[model samples]
Structures are given as structure tokens and as C-alpha cells.
Target: MKMVFRWYGTGNDTVTLKQIKQIPGVEGIVWALHDMPAGEEWPMDKILTYKEQADAYGLHLEVVESVNVHEDIKLGLPSRDAYIDNYKKTIEKLATVGVKTICYNFMPVFDWVRTELFKELEDGSTALFYEKAKVDSMDPGELVNRIANELDFTMPGWEPERLKLLAPLFEQYKQVSAEDLWRNLQYFLEQIIPTAERHGIQMAIHPDDPPWPIFGLPRIINSRESIRRLLQLVDSPCNGVTLCSGSLGANPDNDIVAMVHEFKGRIPFAHIRNVRVYDNGDFIETSHRTSDGTVDIAGIVRAYHETGFTGYARPDHGRHIWDEPCRPGYGLYDRALGIMYLWGVWDSMRAGEVAKRA
Candidate 1:
């Protein structure tokens, strides 16, 4: 696997490219133009700027975390066609800069949801926490304000401009159902997959953060079966899945190993992280070590090795350890540590295979 790191960009992130370069085995950065809003075509000049920065550090900008799907596209509004055309344009532009995979999600209101950004763990380090009861009881507006205002930087999904009028967005989604979402997603794929293929890029859909509906919003890409259906939507190699472990691991029923084996060639990018699930249906992010969380991170890496995966993979969200004042889940210390742990497991497995052949 080709390990990578996520960098928000200059000035917007606390972690610098210099620091990311120090991390062993990280060859690239998973990035996007955060200041650019969804549905609009990304500026080529701005895209070139980012490319120049990554080039300075000798880091390949091959994987983009998201070119976010617009609310209009998700709501299946009349304006969706225009937005989709813009998406196609963006895909073509990204291809010119050598981006191999684009990770986007179809979740309606939020990209990822968490009740607490810094819930103290038993070990004193804090991590992103999701409380099921709290999410169910809290008003969407209140929740949005709490998350949007608490962070120093703009959170990926909870863009201030998008959540400024929550009620209207929710109302727009009221007309959309799970089936409608699937149809709209299929339409989107049919439109963009050809563009992605023509440009030598794969469109990988990130599964819903919690793999479940929240605030009555429909989340379709949560389970193994749903992902299977998604692949069949376009029946093309350009159509793919991000295969996030922490997102689908929240459900506990998702067989991530099976997914790796089944979708071997299709998964062009992966977000490997661990989360400890509670009996009460809440979860907290943990280190990548197998014992630290419920997710079989070691097994998952072995699965990739067994399948001869050479795709781009990154250590996903990590705990806010060492008093690091970084993005909620995108901290430096723990993620770097997670990368070391992943390399340990992956390298050992490869060595064992060599021994067997000998």
C-alpha cells in the first residue's frame, strides 16, 4: 500500500508540509481546495497553486479527499444538471494535475457527524466522539452551531455558508427519500463516471460517517450490500468506493476484510483508522493499534497485502494526543503514530510472505 497523509493546506492547517515530510512512508497528501464551495468548478489557477506547493515538498497530490457533492445534487433539485456539469469540469481539471482518485460523499446534510470534538478518553488524550442519544435529542441547528463555532478552522462538511440556513436545507431534503437518493446518485455516476474514466481518474464514494441516517436524513452508502449496489450503478472501473474503516466500523456488522477481498481492484483509496464502540451506541476514535479499538486494523492491512493492494491509503482520523492544538481528528502526533503501526503490520506480513516463498 502507498501510505499518505491529509494536509488541509497552508495557513488553514496547524500541521505544516515540513512536518508531514518528516513522517516515514508518507509519499503524498490527500487534499482539496477547502475555500472553494461545493458545486462550483474549482479554479485552475488555485489548483495549480496547490500543485506547486506539494511539488515543492516532493509530495504527490494524487488523492483528493473530496470535491464535495453539492446540496442541490443531493436534494435532486432542478438545478442539479448545471451543478453536475460543473462537477464534470472539475474532474477534468483535477486530472490535468495528475490526481488519480477523487473521494466524495453523497450524505445529504453533513459529511461526518460527531457530538463531541474532544471527549476525554480514559488515557487522558481526547478524540472525536459520537453520542447516539445526544444526536437524537439535539436540534440540528444547535448541533451545527456547536460544531461550526467550536473549531478554529472550518470543518469539512459543516461549512458555515451551507449551514447558515439549516431549515431550508432540511426542507429541501424532506422531498428526498432513500430511493430517490439512490436514483440521483446513479444519475450523478452516469454523468461523471465517463469523465473520470476519460481523464484516468477513479471516483471513490466515501461511506456515510456513521453508516446510518441522522436527523432523519437518508444515508445510503453505509453497508456492504449498499456498496455492492453502488458498484453496479455504472459497472465501470472508474466507479469505486473509498472503503473507510472507521465509518463502516461504527455499525460493527460490516465485514471490512470481506470488503477488501471483494472490491480489491476498485478501492483506489482507503481511510484506515480505529474506533472503540460502546454498548450504548457511542464511539470514540482510537490509535491504529488493534487492541486500542474495536476495528481489526491489523487484519484489514493484512487483507490489503493478501490482495496485493498498491493503491493510496492514509491513516484516517486520530486522537488529539500530546496536547496538540490541531484539527479535531486530523492531529499530527497520533496520526503519525498510526502510520508507524500500520507499516509495522504491513511490512511484517510482506516479510512473512517472502519467507514462505523461500
Candidate 2:
């Protein structure tokens, strides 16, 4: 596996590329133009600026975490064609700069929802937490207010400009079922997959954050079966998955190892992280270590190794640790630690394989 780190960008993030390059096995940054709104063409100058910065530190900016899909596209609105055109242009621009994989999601509004940003663990480190009961019962406005109050960094899915119309957007999606979401996603894939293939960029769709619907919002890419269906939508190597462990792991039933074995070649990127699931149906993000959480991270790494995965993989959201105050989940300290943990596991697995062959 080719390990990469997710860096928001200079000024927008506290973690520098210098720091990221210091990580033993990290070779690149999984990045995007975070300040730009979805459906807008990313300025080539701005993309080159990031490229130059990363190159200065010997890091490749090849895997983009997200080129967020506009709600119009997800809703199948008439204006979606215009937005999709912008998306295609953005894809072309990314390809120009040597980006290999573009990670995007088709979730309606919120990218990922958490009732609490800093749910303190017993160990004193905090993590992004989702209280299922609270989320189920809390008023949507109250939840929004809570998220807005806690996070200083702009949360991925909760863009203020978009959330301002949350009520109406939710109303619009009321009639949109899971099947409708699947159809809309297929529509998006049909338009973009050919363009992506032409540009030599793989379109890697991230699974829904919790791998389940939230507040009645339809989430279709939540299971291995759904992923299989998604692959069938475009039926091209360019159409792929980001294969996020924490997201898919939230649903206990998802056989992530089976997914790795089944979709081995199609996954061009991966977000490997761990989460501790509670008996009450809630969960909080944790370190990448296998023992620290419910996810069998060690097994996951071995699976990747077994598949001979040479794709770009990054440590996903990590707990806030070591008094380092930054973006709640995107903090540098824990993520760097997470990287080393993953690398340790992968190296051991590789060594074991060599020994077995010998």
C-alpha cells in the first residue's frame, strides 16, 4: 500500500507538509480545494499552488479527499447538468496536475454527522462521536447549532452556505428514497465515468459516513452489496471506491475483509481508521491500533497486503491527542501516530509473507 496523509492545506491546516513528509511511509497528501464551493471549477492556479507547496517538501498531491458533488446532482435537478459540467472540468484540471484518484461522495447534504465533536474517552483523549439515540431524537436545527458551536474548522458536509437551506433541502429529499439515491448516483456515474476514464483519473466514491441513513436522508453506499451494485453502475476501472474502513465499519454487519478481497482491483484509495462502537448503537473514532477499537485494523491491513494493493491509502479521522488543538478529527499528532501504527502492521505482514515464501 502507498500511504498518504490528508492535509487540509496551508493556513487552513495546522499540520504542514514538512511534518507530513517526516512520517516514515507517507508519500503524498490527500487534499482538495476546501474553500471553494461545490460545482465550481477549481482554479488551475490554485491547484498548482498546492502542487508546488507539496512538491517543495517532496510530497505528491495526487489523491484528493473530495471534489464534493453538488446537491443538485444528488437531487437529479435540471441544473445538475450545469453542475456536472463544472465537475467534469474540475476532473480534467486535476488530471492535468497528475492526480490519480478523486474521492467524492453523493450524500445529499451533510457529509458526516456527529452529535459531539469531542466526546471525551476514558483515556482523556477525545474523538468524533455519534450518539445514535441523541441523533435520532434531537431536532435537526439543534444538531446543526451544536456542530456549528463546537467546530472552528469548516466541517466537510456542513458547509454554512448549504446548511442555511437545511430545512428546505431536507423537505426536498423527503420523497427521495434509497432507490432514488441509487438512480441519481448512477446518473452521476454515467456522466462522469467516461470523462474520468478519458482523463486517466479514477473516480473514487466514499461510502456514507456512518454507512447508514441519517435523519431520514437516504444513504445507498453503505454495504458490500451496495458497493457491488455501484461498480455495476459504470462498469469501468475509472469508477471505483475509496474503501473507507471507519465508515463501513460502523455497520457491524459489513464484512470489510470480504469487500477488500472482492473489490481488490477497483479500490484506488482507502481511508483506514478505527472506531469504538458502543452497545447502545453509538460510536466514536479511535486510534488506528486494532486493540483500541472494534475495527480489526490489523486484519484489514493484512487483507490489503494479501491483495497486493499498491493504491493510495491514508489514515482517516483520528482522535484529538497530546494537547494538540486543531481540527477535531484532522489533528496531526494522532494521525501521524496512526500512520506509524498502520505501517508497523503492514511491514510485519510483508516480512511474514517473505518468511513464508523462503
Candidate 3:
């Protein structure tokens, strides 16, 4: 596994590239042009600016966390063709800057959701939390307000521009079912995968945040079976998965390790993190340690090792520790710690391999 860190870019993030480089084994940053709206072509100058900054710190800015998909594309609207054209252009621009992977998601309305951003754990560290009962009963407006009020930075999925069109977007999806969503995703992959293959960039689709349908939204990338179906959609190496553990682990039924082993060649990126699930079907993000949460971090690492995975991997959501006051889940302290934890596992696995060779 090639370890990378998620750096939200200078000024936009509290963590600096200098700090990220200090983390042992982290060789790259998973980044994107966060300021650019979806369906717009990313400026080449801006892309080079980020590349220069990361290079200054001796880090690669190759894997972007997301290139946000416009709602038009997900809805399969007539205007989607125009937006998709913009997306293809952006892909070409990224390829020019040596980007190896672009992680995007097809979930409509929201990218990820949590009822509380800083739900305090018993240990005093806080994490992104989702209360199932509260979310189930939440008024959309109230939920939006709660999320908007808590975040200091503009949350990726809850952009104000997109929220303004929420009602209409929901209306657009009123007749759209799970099957329709799948068809729309397939349509999207068909248009973009060939371009991605030509550019030598893999389009890694991130799974739905909770790996389940939320608030009547039809989430397609939630399970291993769904992932298999997705691979069949484009049937190309360029069409791949990000293999996020925190997202898929929310659903207890997802066998993440097995999926890693099964989809080895097709997985070009991974977001490895842990979450503690409650009895009531709620969950909160936790440290990368196996004992700290439900997801088996060590087992997942071993599976990746077994598969000889040389793809880019990064630590996902982390607790807000040391009163650092960083992005809700993208804090530097815990994520840096998570990297060391992952590296320890990878190192041990490599040492074992060396010993066996001897």
C-alpha cells in the first residue's frame, strides 16, 4: 500500500503540507480544487499551483478525494451531457498534472451526513456522529441548519448553492427508483471511462457515506454485490472503486476485507478508517486502531498486503483531538496518528514476507 494524506490545500485547511510530510510513510496528498463548483472545468493554472505547493513539501498531489458530480448527471437530466463534458475536460487537466486517481461519488443530494459533528466520546475526544433515530425524524431544513451551523468550513456536499436547489432536486428524483439510479450511473461510466483510460487516470467512485439509502435517496454503491455490478457497468480497469472502509463498514453486512481481496486489481485507492457502531444502528468515526472501533483495521491491511496492493491509500475521518479545532473529520492530529497505525501494520506484514523469503 502507498500511504497518502488528505490535505485540503493551503488556507482552506488547518493542516500544512509540511506537517503531512513529517508523517512517516506518507508519500502523497489526496486533494481536489475544493473552490471549483461541480460541472466546471478546473483551471490548469490552479491545478499547477497546488502541484507546486505539494512539490515544495516533497509530496505528490495525485489522488483527489473527489471531483464532485453535478446533480444533473445523477438525475440523468438533458443538461447532464454538458456537465459530463466539463467533467471529461477536468479529467484531462488532472492527467496533465500527473494525477493517478480521481475519487468521485454518484450519491444524490448529500455526499455524507452526520447528525452531530462533535459528538463527545467518553474519552473526551470527539468524532463525527450519526444518530439514526434523530436522522430518521429530522426535518430536512433543520438538519441542514444544524450541519451548516456547526461547520466552520463549507462542508463538501452541503454547499449552499446545491442546498438552494434541494427541493427541486428531490422533486426531480421523485419518480427515480434504485434501478433508475443504477442506469444513470451506468450511463455516466459509459461516457467517462474511455476518456479516463486514455488519460491514464483511474476514476475511483467512493461508496455512499453510510453504505445505505438515506432519507429516501437511492444509494447504489453500498455493498460488495453493488460494487460487482458497478464493475460490470464499464468493464474497464479505468472504472474502479475507492474502497472506503468507514463508509462501507457502517453497514455491518459489508465484508470489506473480502471485497478488498476480490476487487484488488480494480481498486486504485482506499480510505481506511474505523467507526464505532451502536446497538441502535448509529455510528461515529473513530481512530484507525482495531480495538478502538468495530472495523478490523489490521485484517483489512493484511488483506491488502495479501493482494499485493500497491495502490494509493489514505486515513479517512478522524476524531478531533488535542483541542486542535480543525475540520470536523479531517483533523491533522488523529489522521497523522492513523497513518502511523496503518504503517505499523504494513511494516509488520512486509517484515513477515521478508522473513518467509529468507
Candidate 4:
């Protein structure tokens, strides 16, 4: 697999390109036009600016973490047609700059819900955490305020502009059942997947964080079965899943290794991280080490190896470590350490294969 690192744009991130370039085996940056609002076509000049910066650091700008889905499209409104058209154009624009995969999610209202952004871990590090009790107790408005308060960097799904419409957005979705959400998603895929294919880009959907509905909202992309159905929606190579371990692993029942085998050709981007799930339905982002979290990092990697996956794989959210001033889970030291641990496993597997041939 081709290793990549997630790099928010200059001044938008605490981690620097020079620091990312130092990570061994990282050949690309999983990026996006973050400043571009949802449903708007990205500025061509801004896209070129990102390319120029990555090029200066000798990094490939191949995979974008998210080109967010507009709410109208997710709501299946009549206005959705306009947003879909905009998304199609965004796909074409990103393709022009060699972006191979556009990772996104269809979850309504919130992108990913977390009770704590900096929950202190046992080792003095902090991690993005989900407290089931707190989530159940708090309203969406309070949660939104908490998420936006003291945010060091961009939280993809927690965009303030989107959250500001919380009341109206929830009202719009009150009538939206899971089935309605699924239908809207299909409508979106049928319209845009072909465009993505034509542009040589894969439209990869990230799984619903926590793999469950939050605040009575519909979250359809949760389990293995849901993803199986999602692939069938468009049934094209360009339409695929991002195969996020932490998100899927929250359920404890998602067999991530099996998913690798099930959707082999479809997955063009992999967010390989770990999360420790508690019996209380809570979860926290953990290190890449298999023992640190519920997800089988080694098995997942070996499965990708067996598939001979050559797509972009990036170390996902990492804990705040070494007292580093970072954007919650987007800290550099732990994520860099995560890459080493992930590569160490993959390289060991490769060595074993080479020895067998010898």
C-alpha cells in the first residue's frame, strides 16, 4: 500500500509539511479544499495552490479526505439537483489536479459526534472520545457549541457554518427516516459516481462515526451489511468505501479484515487507525498498535497485503502525546509514531514473504 499523511493546509495546522515529509514511507498527503464551503465548486486557483505546496515538499496530492456532501443532497430536497451538479464539478476539478479518491460521508446534521475532543488518556496523552452517557444527555445545540469552542483546527464534519443551522437542519431531517436517507444517498451516488468514474476518481464514503444514529438523526453507513448495500447502490468501481477502522470498530462487531477482502477493488483509500470500545458503548481513538485498540491492525494490514492493495493508506486520528499543542486527535508526534508502528508491521509481513521465496 502507498502510505500517506493527513496534512491540513499551511497555517491551518499545527503540523508542518517539513514535519510530514520526515515521516518514513509517507509519499502523499490526504488533503482537501477545506475552505471551500459545502455544495460550492472549489476555486481552481486554490486547488492549484495546494498542489504547488505539496509539490514543493515533493509530496503527492492524490487523495482528499473529504469533499463534503451538501445537506440538500442528503435531505433529498428539490434543491439537491443544484448541489449534485456542484459536487460533480468539484470531482472534475479535483481530478484535474491528480486526486485519485474523494472521501466523504452521508451522515446528516453532524459529520461525526464526539463527547470529548481531548479526553485525557492513562499515559497523559489526550484522544478524541465518545461518552455514551454524555451524548444521550446533551442536546445538539450544546454539543455543537462544545465542538466549536476552542477548536484548534478544522474538524471536518463539525464545520461551524453547517452546525449553525442546527435547529433548521434537524427540523428538515425530522421526517427523514433511515430509508429516506438511503434513497437520497443512492440518488447522489447514481448522479455523481459516473462523473467520478469519468474523471478517474473514486468516490469513497467514510463510515458513520460510532456506526449509529446520534440525536435521533439517521446514520445509514454503519455496519458491514450497510456498506454491502452501499456498494450495490452504484455498483461501479468509482463508487467505494474509505474503510475507516476506528469508525467501524466502534460497533465491535464490524469485521474490518473481512471488509478488506469483501470490497477489495472498491476501496481506493484506507484510514487505518484503532479505537478502544467499552462495554458502556463508549469509544476512544487509540494508537495503531493492535493491542492498544479493538481493531486488528495487523490482520487488517495483512488482508490489504493479500489483496495486493496499492491505493493510498493514511494513519488516522492519533492521541495528543508528549504535551504537544495540537488539534485534538490530529497531533503530529503520536500520528508519526503511528506510521512507524503501522509500517513496521507491513514491512515485517513483506520480509516474511521474501524469506519464503528465498
Candidate 5:
């Protein structure tokens, strides 16, 4: 696994590139132009600037977390063609910067949903929490306000610009079902995968966080079977999955190890994180240690190793440990700690393999 870190960018993030470089085994940054809104083609100069910054710190800018597929594209509106055209242009520019993978999601209203950003854990360190009851009972508008008010920085998916159109977006989505989403997603893949193939960039779709529909919104890209169906949509290497552990792990039914083996060559990026789920259906992000959460992170890494995965992987989200006031899930201390834990697991496996050969 070629380990990477998620750096929001200069000024937008509390963690600096200097700090990221200090983390052992991290060779690249998973980044994007967060300031740029959806559907707009990213400027070449801006893309170059990020490239320059990563180069300065000896970090490769090969994996972009998202290009933020526009709502129009997900909604399958007539204007989607224009946005998709722009997406193709953005893909071309990112390819210029040597970006190997572009991670985007097709979740309709929100990229990911959490009821609490700092839900205190038993150990006193806090982490992103998802309360199923709260999500089911709360109004979508109210949930937006609660989440927005808590964040010092604009959360990626909960952008004010997009949330402003929430009512109409919800109304529009009311007309869209799971089948409709699958068809629209297929349309998107068919349109863009050829361009991605030509540019040598893997277009990875991140699975829906919580792996379930929320606020009456249809979520299709969550389950293992659904993922298999997704791969069949375009049937090209460029069309792929991000293989996020925490997102798909919420379902518990998703055999992540099986996915590692099954989707072997197609996954170009992996988000390795842990979450502890309760019988009540609430979950809180935990340290990357396998014991700390329900996810079999070590097993997942083992599977990756066994499959000869050399793709870009990152410690996805982390707890608010050491009183470090950082992005809700994207903190320095815990994520760095997570990286070490991952390395320990992976390296031990390597050592075991060498011993067997000997």
C-alpha cells in the first residue's frame, strides 16, 4: 500500500504539509480545490499551485478526495450534461498534475451525514458520531443548521451554497428512486469513464456514509452487491470504487476483506478507518487500532497485502484526541497514530511472509 494523507490545503486546514511530511510512510496528499464549487471546471493555475505546494514538501498530489460531482449530475437534470462536460475538463486538468485517482461520490443531498461532530467517547476523546434515531427524527433543515453551526470551517458536503437549494433539491429527489439513481450514475460513468481511461486517472466513487438512505434521500452505492453492479455499469478499469472502510463498515454486513479480494485490481484508493457501532445503531469514529472499533482494520490491511495492493491508501477519519481542535474527523494526532497502527499491521504481515519464504 502506498500510504497518503488527506490535506485540506493551505489556510483551509489546521494541519500543515510540514506536519504531514513528518508522518512516517506517508508519501502523498489526497486533496482537492475545496473553495471551488461543484460543476465548475477547476482552473489549471489553481491545480498547478497545489502541485507546486505538494512538490515543495516532497509529497505527491496523486489522489484527489473529490471533484464534487454537481447536484445537477446526481439529480439527472437537463443541465447535467453541462456539468458533466465541466467534470471531463476538470479530469483532464487533474491528469496534467499526475493525479492517478479522482475520488467522487454520487450521494444526493449530503456527502456524509453525522449527528454530532464531537460526541464525547468513554475515554474523554471525542469523534464524529452518527445517531440513527436523531437522523430519522430530525428535520433535514434543522440537521443542516446544527451541523453548520458546529463547524468553524465549511464542511465539504454541507456547503451553504448547496444547502440553500435544499428544499428544491429535496423536492427534486422525491421524484428519484434507487433505480433512478443507478441509471443516472450509469449515465455519468458512461460519459466520463472513457476520458478518465485516456488520461490514466481512476474515477473512484466513494460509498455512501452509513451506507443507507437518509432524510428520504435514495442512496444506491452502499452494499457489496450494489458495488458489483456499479462495476458492471461501465465495465472499464477507469470506472472504479474508492473502497472506504468506515462508510461501508457502518452496515456491518459489508465484508470488507471479501471486497479487498473481490475488487482487487479495480480499487485505486482506500480509506482505512474504524467505527464502533452499538445495538442502538449509533456509531463513533475510533483510532485505527483494530481493537478500538468494530471494523477489522488489520484484517482489511492483510487482505490488501495478500492481494498485492500497491494503490494509494490513507487513514480516513480520526478521533479528536489530545485535545487537538482540528477538523471534526480530520485531526493530526489520531490520524498519525492510525497510520502507525496500519503500518505495524502491514509490516508484521510482510515480516511473516518473509519468514515463511525463508
Candidate 6:
């Protein structure tokens, strides 16, 4: 597996590219142009600026976190064709910078939902937390405000532009069922997947944050069966899954290791993280260590090794440690620690394989 780190650009992030380079095995940065809004084509100069910055640090700028899919496309509006064309142009430009995979989601309102950004645990180090009861009981508008209030930087999915249109977006989605969303997604894939194929880039669709519907939104990309169906939608090597352990792991039913084995060549990017899940349906992001969370980090790494996975892998969200003020889940310390843990797992597995072969 090729290890990569998620670096929010120059001024937007607390972690610097130099710090990222210090991590032993981090081969690249999973990056994006965060300032640009959805449906707008990214400028070529901006894309090359990121490439130059990563090159300065000897890091590859191959995996982009997201290129936001406009709600018009998800709504399958008459204007969706125009947005899809914009998406195609963005893909072609990213290809110019040698970006191999573009990680994005199709959630209607929020990209990911969490009730608390710094929910303190018994250990004193805080992490992103989800309280199921809070999400179910709270008004979404209030929830968005609460989340925005906690962040110094704008949260990606909860952008003010999208949030301002929430009421109308919900009204638009009122007529869209899960099936309609699937059809719209298929339409999107049909239009853009061919372009992605021609450019040699993989369109890695991130699974729904919690792998379930929230605030009455129909979330279709939530399970193993949904993944299977998604692959059938475009039926091309270019159309693929991002396979995030924490997101899909929110649902206990998802067999992440099995997905590693089953989706073998179809997965181009993997977001490896752990979460401590409770019986009441709430979860907290935990360190990448296997014992710290419910997800089996060791087993997942082993499966990847067995499948001969050489695609990009990243240590996903991490805890806020050392009292460092950083993005809620994108902190540097814990994520760097997570990378060490992942490297340990991967190295041990490699040693075991060598011993067996000998």
C-alpha cells in the first residue's frame, strides 16, 4: 500500500508540508482546492500550485480529497448536464497534474455528520463524536450552526452557500427517493466516467459518512450491497469505491476486510481509521491502533496485503491530541501516530509473509 497524508493547503491547515514529509512512509498528500465552490471548474494554475508545493516537500499530489458534486447534479435537475460538463473539465485538469483518484461523495445535504467535535473521553484526549440521540432530536439548522460555531475553518460539506439553500434543497430532495438518487448517480457516472477513463483517473466515490440516512436524506451508498450495485452502475475500471473503514464501519454489518478482498482491483483509494462504537448507535473516532477501536485495523491491512493492493491509502480522521488547535478530525499528531501504527501492521505482515515463503 502507498501511504498518503491529508494536507489542507498552505494557510488553511495547521499542519505544514514539512511535518507531513517527516512521517516515515507518507508518499503523498490527499489534497483539494477547498476555496472553490461546487459546480465550478478548478483553474489549472491553482492545481499546479498544489503540485509545486508538494513537489517542494518530495510528496506526490496524486489523490484529491474531493471535487464537490453540485446538488443540481444530485437533484438531477435540467441544468445537471451543465454541472456534469463542469465536473468533466475539472477531471481533465486534475489529470494534467497527475492526480490518480478523486475522492468525492453524493450526500444531499451534509458530507459527514457528528454531534460533537471535541467530545472528551475518559483518557482526556478528545476526538470527533457522534451521539445518535442528538442527531435524531436536534434541528438540522441548529446542528449546522453548532458545528460551524466550533470550527475556525469552514467545514467542507457545511459550506455557507449550501447551508443557505438548505430549505430549498430539502424541498428539491423531497421528491427524490433513494431510487431516484441512484438513477441520478447513474446518470452522473454515465456522463463523467468515460472522461475519467480516458484521462486514466479513478473516480472513487466515498461512502456515506455514517453509512446511513440522516435528517431525512436518502443515503444510498451505505452498505456492501450498495457498493456492489454501484460498481454495476458504470461497469468500468475508472468507476470505483474509496472504501473508508470509519464511515462504513459505522454500520456494524459492513465487512471492511471482506470488501478489501471482494472489491480487489476496484478500490483505488482506502481511508483507514478506527472508531469505538457503542450499542446505542453512537461512535467516537479512535486512534488507528486495533485495540483502541472496534474496527480491525490489523485484519484490514492483512487483507490488503493478501490482495496485492498497491493503490493509495491514507490515515483518515484522528483525535485532537497535545492540546493542539487544529481541524476537528484532521489534526497532525494523532494522524501521524496512526500512520506509524499502520506501518507497524503492514511491516509485521510483510515480515510474516517473508518468513512463510522462506
Q: How many pairs of residues collide in each model?
A: 0, 0, 0, 0, 0, 0
Model 3: lDDT to the true structure: 0.91
lDDT values for all models: 0.93, 0.90, 0.91, 0.90, 0.93, 0.93
lDDT of 1 by residue, 170-256 (tens): 988888999999999999999999999899999999999999999999999999999999999999999999999999999889999
The digit string of per-residue lDDT tens for model 5 on 169-274 reads 9999999999999999999999999999999999999999979999999999998899999999999989889999999999888899999999999899999999
In candidate 1, which residue ranges exceed 4 Å CA deviation? none
lDDT of 2 by residue, 176-209 (tens): 8888888889999999999999999999999998
RMSD in angstroms between candidate 4 and the native structure over all alpha carbons: 0.9
Any runs in candidate 5 off by more than 4 Å, and if so which?
Answer: none
RMSD of 6: 0.8
Candidate 4 structure quality by residue, lDDT tens digits, 1-358: 9999998898889998889999999998989878778889888999999999999999999999889999999999999999899888888888889999889999897888898888888888889999999898888899888878968677788887898888999998999999999999999999998898888999899999879988999899988899999999989999999999989999988899999999899899999999999999999998899999889999999999989998889999999988899887888999999899888888898999999999
Query: Model 2, which residues run further than 4 Å from truth?
Result: none
- Model 6 residue 317 lDDT score: 94
Q: What residue pairs are clashing in model 6?
A: none
TM-score of each: 0.99, 0.98, 0.99, 0.98, 0.99, 0.99
- What TM-score would candidate 3 get against the native? 0.99
TM-score, structure 5 vs. true:
0.99
Write one digit per residue (lDDT tens) for candidate 6, span 1-358: 9999998898899999999999999989999999999999999999999999999989999999889999999998999999899999999999988999999999988999999999997889999999999999988888988888888876789888888998888888999999999999999999999999999999999999988888899999999899999999999999999999999998888899999999999999999999999999999999999989999988999899999999999999999999989989999999999999888988998999899999
> Between 2 and 5, whose lDDT is larger?
5
Give the distance in Å from residue 65's predicted Cα in candidate 5 to where it truly belongs. Answer: 1.1
Error of model 6, residue 323, in angstroms: 1.1
Candidate 1: C-alpha RMSD after superposition: 0.7
